[model samples]
Target: MDLDRASSELNEKLSAIGGTANVAVLKSVVTQASSAIPVMPLYIAMVFKKMREEGVHEGCMEQIYRMFSQRLYKADGTAPEVDDQNRLRLDDWELRDDIQQHCRDLWPQITSENLKELTDYQEYKDEFLSLFGFGIEGIDYEADVNPNVAFDVIDI
Candidate 1:
């Protein structure tokens, strides 16, 4: 069977289990499996767009800050919250019902022509480029730099 069919069957099986939570898990799995599947990239793009519109989009720095300040080192010394499986739920915001529902509602309406109009593909591309320091601000990509520059290592 083709990937889309397999994905559809998986959705059917998950739906048979009868829970929105299970669907959410399926969506997460699909998003993570984007490398192997074709449609998942589009799904991820839509999800990211929805997240940005909701004002809950977070980059690596923001997520790390939350993990450190809220989870790892709380001022009250309380233990970090975990799910039933004893896993940190740092992705709680992205897995929210409203966000997922918005993506679900928009998924069917997306097409190659409407991709930019319906999704945050441009922002996604920019963020992906920024990972390699390409689109960052205040940096001269054309400037020459010494490859062996040494810096002090401070251990805390």
Candidate 2:
């Protein structure tokens, strides 16, 4: 997959954010979300691990807020720059030079033996399942907790 082109596109996107940008895009080769996708799981894991070490990560809400409330607005809050399709390109931050360089260095060195130590695969898997009410951290599924409750009703 055109790695150079991808890198260039990432850099171009990041540069779109002029001064006063609230978010920066960072490239990730792997994340919990991509674990199930074939052909690149190990690469993704290594990337995720590297990024975590660098303290660069953003969830869905943080990204959306930065897009409209921060990057899109001018200094005086008068206007937002948009393309012909009225879209704010937030993916640019991921292509920054430092991030790209780190990923490139890690790409060839990752292996199955060191995967667990380097990546947060198990942690991410737990978090992903917890979202759907499975494998929650504190609450025990096998506990005697009751799911049914009674509410008072009055007939008029």
Candidate 3:
């Protein structure tokens, strides 16, 4: 009934068979866009870890390019692949059975003390920061830049 017990039971069920029932429960409980279930961060971190280790991790731009080039605009002119609900399955890599199973296996072993050891929390933090243009390669964050730069406007 308590949070910890509920989380533990969910983890047990998830790890036992990687069941969709537990995933549905997680999805229902974390309905708000800005809110998440208690274990989601850890689960995502583990998923990232496994994906990176397997060399299948991709950035947002790469995913979009793949979607357009390989799926949406294929040279063969065949119809794009879609799921049962008629949505494009662009997340096929992320939803691979091996990746899901890996995350499930790591679910029960994770704890506050072993979080960094068991998951890619650091990478997650870095990626989150990159959204605001931080941690980008070849850019000098410490360099001073003129706040105002004059640019010529072209009339259409």
Candidate 4:
């Protein structure tokens, strides 16, 4: 992966917002992509739109919570799995009103922005590569996986 190209793309988009993006941050975002390509632009759009609507801006913890919660999100885009049972287990209490409102506000914008930016198959493939750790930092994937390792519980 050409980090220089990825870094340039990340800075270019951030520059439009009068902000600076560092390599570490870029690498983190790039690593999250499903493809090896830098997906910062898509992230920027998603984050900006979500911040506008959600009112409750999320840090990493909130991000993980929402993402994990939405893994079973419905086909109609509703929080199908975040029921009382889930809320009680996941949070200290039941599904709080504030949480519902936040999701209601942000989900639409997140969905719309992602749909808009990631509709292309080429882009999808690139994004997927990054998701699987292809474009991330501190990972020299050029060294091949040890094919000799096996699922065997003991030496045969």
Candidate 5:
């Protein structure tokens, strides 16, 4: 696929939101699946950079918080609501006041030079690595290790 054109088109759509948009570029740590794809990592990173510049970058935690806390409730504080198709309102949570406020506080302080130190991207990367038995902080990757997985049939 044309990564540049795709990325540009996505950014253009985001820009059309007029700064009132809650559009967030969802990214996670690199995984075996993503690493196997030729351009996935670079594409994700570029999209992340663009979204950051657009002040719409958000991590997984933020997305989860928005999903559960902001979208599940009814305006009358009674029954849960859903979309026209009855699907969960997952995408709208980033527009919440607290979430936006928190993002606003962090977004301006992020920079390319200090992205690792300043943003949760590093942590997300580490978490992603951990899923594949890598990138755990305080764990020695240089040492020999044993990796195993055992699943209980009934419980699992």
Candidate 6:
């Protein structure tokens, strides 16, 4: 459901517990799948540069593909992601219609070599995760998770 509908439902549930209109409700978030990522800003410089120079600018899908095509593979017809981890990212399949159109529009004359460097999704996923302060280079996950800490600011 949409944000307003979810928030109203949340308020209704809170009312059942005599908790409606609590100030904390304003700060609470209903978990959502489409929250914006902060990492794209950092890559703006590179993306704009690529767009201007190579005329190859892309959003998440294309960028993921580009990552794969570049760092993850070479000229021959070999697919990796089928490695020991058995970690299969359906990034190619995840390329939505609009996104594919956007990519084609950006570089209508794309070459075979260009399309080959398609995605380093796992690496991209790691970079995306690190943006939320959860997976830093120095932090140790096993040593750290403090259960006593509440999930929200009010509880803290």
The local distance difference test score of model 2 is 0.58
Candidate 3 local Cα displacement, residue 142, angstroms:
12
In terms of TM-score, which candidate is strongest? 1
In the range 27-80, model 5's lDDT, one tens digit per residue, is: 433567876688455444444444565576666676666655655444555544
**Per-residue lDDT of candidate 3, residues 79-125 (tens digit):** 66655433455667777899989887888888889989989887766
Candidate 4 Cα outliers beyond 4 Å, as residue runs: 1-90, 112-137, 149-156
Each candidate's TM vs. the true structure? 0.61, 0.54, 0.60, 0.24, 0.40, 0.24
Better of 1 and 2 by TM-score: 1
After superposition, candidate 5 runs with Cα above 4 Å error = 1-38, 74-127, 144-156
When sorted by lDDT, best at the front, the candidate numbers are 1, 3, 2, 5, 4, 6
Residue 126 miss distance in model 5 (angstroms): 4.2
* TM-score, cand. 2 vs. native: 0.54
Best by lDDT: 1
Task: In angstroms, give how far residue 18 of model 6 lies from its true place.
Answer: 52
| Model 6 lDDT-worst window of ten | 22-31
Give the runs in model 1 whose Cα sits over 4 Å from its true position: 1-37, 132-156
Off by over 4 Å in 2: 1-35, 39-44, 78-87, 141-156
Per-residue lDDT value at 58 in model 3: 72
Candidate 6, overall lDDT?
Answer: 0.42
Residue 82 deviation, candidate 3, in Å? 1.0
Count of backbone collisions in candidate 3: 0
